[model samples]
Target: MRGGEAATLEAVLQSVEDPEIPVVSVVELGIVRGLDAGQVTITPTYTGCPATAVIEANIREALDQAGFEDIQIKTVLSPAWSTDDITDAGRQKLKAYGIAPPPKGAKAASLCNKSVAECPHCGSINTREISRFGSTPCKALWQCNSCHEPFDRFKCH
Candidate 1:
């Protein structure tokens, strides 16, 4: 991806943070699809996600800063991204940041919007969706009945 091996490029990519969720890096969020010589592939949380462009810009800047200006950034939409793409570390970060992580197999259950989101604050399952949209388009506003605290949960994509 850079002058030689892909691991160096990976390290650089791993440092690129997600703008919407600053607590986790793009890699942790599974935005990075693959790395290889001459190119770095990525997939956004969703195709029309507003942060997609910003994410590419941020990655470009990071690559440039890490001397990977020659490596091209490629975005792919096919086989589209899913909430399952989120890494375990990313899930933990979301919880620590006071956001509920999407439940496993959330994608198929998305249409119902009935997947129970564990309350990050009180670890309770009693939560209700307050809004379909959250601070960011990729997330939904949810309120934990146990803690009475509102939190963002990545929509089951």
Candidate 2:
């Protein structure tokens, strides 16, 4: 595979959206670690994330559509995934999709301090944590004071 082929493969992978978060593609979310002519390696944003199966299926379909019938999908657990790996564009897309992005600079240990995850609807910093687990185990539920709207907070890993 050469220039066009490599680019096409990349594009196909980029088109594979995260099943859980449809707005952000695996590529944009920084989940796809690497893509080769015959293989794709990805690290889950959350350990034991249920979306792993869907992501794998998407990768297989994407590469197969790109003419790569033989695929090797590897899930790497080392270096563990984190919300910090998500790109700025991916964060924006997440917000656009109505899901609040993770708090910037909000380390896993600093859950008490208000990070950068402003309410997507009201842009308010005064938010209350409702639950540690949201719709998915990867996110937390939060309620904004300004809008009184409840939203999911992408957990800051």
> Which has the greatest lDDT?
1
The TM-scores of all predictions, comma-separated, are: 0.91, 0.89
The digit string of per-residue lDDT tens for model 2 on 2-111 reads 78877887888889999988888998888888876567889987767889888988889878877788778888877777777788999998888778987565665655
lDDT of 2: 0.81
lDDT of candidate 1 over 1-157, digit per residue (tens): 2355577778888888899889999998989998875888999786678899999999999999988778899989877888888999999998899888877677776544666888888889998999998888778899999989888887777
Error of 1 at 25 (Å): 0.8
Name the regions of candidate 1 deviating beyond 4 angstroms: 1-4, 110-112
- Candidate 2 regions off by >4 Å? 107-116
Best by TM-score: 1
Instruction: Report every candidate's CA lDDT.
Output: 0.85, 0.81
Q: What lDDT score is found at residue 61 in candidate 2?
A: 86
Error of 1 at 95 (Å): 0.8
